[model samples]
Target: MKNKLIKMLVGIGLVMGLAACGGGGEDTASGGTDSAHADAEKIYNQKCSSCHGDNLKGGMGPELTAVGANYSQDEIADIIQNGQGAMPAGLISGDDLDKVAEWLATKK
Candidate 1:
């Protein structure tokens, strides 16, 4: 009975983990993120293009995808707000930042 109970708990845990993955992260295509991203991209071109390149191909600043695959949207937003390594803070704000994060993640 003890062994059976442990297996049952493990099965439950696995199911819960899978369900957690079906998260509610906003989709850029249909949501307000689309327009927001447009706003953010314009901010990028104006404030960041000099260092990161017009398309974020990298110039004075590291490529936007420096570690793209490993980061999440929230993490990117925080980075944008706090600024990283060679980047400065407060260049973008609120909805614009969130949208940029979504666009950057899809780059590669």
Candidate 2:
């Protein structure tokens, strides 16, 4: 009887752990803004800082400190994917593009 009770508790614990594993990062549902931004900023610094500046202050590229004021997340993603003006297309893509765009969209 004790063994059966332990097994049931272990199963319940496993299910709870799995249930807490997904979503909540993108929209701040988990309140992990710093972690999410750190990840996105890491990607940005790797792929975009050379042109956009370390703090989005602009370098060879225009300042993006307020880019969200002008562009929505989808718009920013389109720009990143398609290229705009002197910016080359596809400098970043896939999940990286989505993350960067989502982070930047909050800059406003």
Candidate 3:
């Protein structure tokens, strides 16, 4: 399985997801100014911009804004963990998945 290949990329055969990731903006949690969302955008710009676009308007990958319509944060997390369409799974799991979902949720 391709997942296996990805898993193999780990150092010393450890099992870890592909990206540095975590849950959504914590500023929303601590009653901050949604700085967490800002962090999410920054993360997206660095990791997802290549395919999804800087503004998330769409490019090689589907447009990220309003992705929550078809998928929830949890679902998106799954895609990040398992791969979909032309995307490779497990590349954006854990924190990174949460970050993307948090940013995408605010695309409205």
Candidate 4:
């Protein structure tokens, strides 16, 4: 009986541990403004910063600091998805594309 009770407690603990491991009411994909921004920043650093510069200033790529002023969100999204000039195509896509575009639009 004691062994059964201990096993039952262990099972309950395991179930609770699994439940706690799962994100609680958090949108793991996009979350909120802060999370989206953090995601965007991470993506940019990984993929774009090499060419666009860490602060979005010009590097091998033209300065993106004023890109928001020059291009609409849709246009920026298109450029990122399709590429232009020396820039290659399909650098980023899906939800990341949208997040990066929206985040970049706020640069200006």
RMSD to the true structure for each prediction, in A, is: 17.1, 17.9, 7.1, 17.7
Off by over 4 Å in 1: 1-36, 65-67
Best by TM-score: 4
lDDT of 2 by residue, 2-108 (tens): 99677556644543343344223234455476766876787777667766788999866789999999999999999999988766676667766888899999988
For candidate 1, the per-residue lDDT at 107 reads 62
Clashing pairs in 2: none
Error of 4 at 49 (Å): 0.5
- Output the worst ten-in-a-row residue range by lDDT, candidate 3: 10-19
Decreasing TM-score order of the candidates: 4, 2, 3, 1
Error of 1 at 43 (Å): 2.2
> How many clashes would you count in candidate 1?
0
Question: After superposition, which runs of candidate 2 have C-alpha atoms over 4 Å from their true positions?
Answer: 1-31
Q: Which ten residues in a row have the lowest lDDT in candidate 2?
A: 18-27
Candidate 2 versus truth, CA RMSD in Å, comes to: 17.9
Can you give the TM-score per candidate against the true fold? 0.59, 0.68, 0.63, 0.71
The residue-by-residue lDDT of candidate 3 on 11-77, one tens digit each, is 2122122134423323445534366667777666656665667777876667887787777777777
* lDDT of predicted model 4: 0.74
**Residue-by-residue lDDT tens digits, candidate 4, 47-106:** 677667889996666899978898988999999889887666667778878888988988
Candidate 4: where are CA atoms >4 Å away?
A: 1-30
Comparison by TM-score, 1 against 3, better one:
3
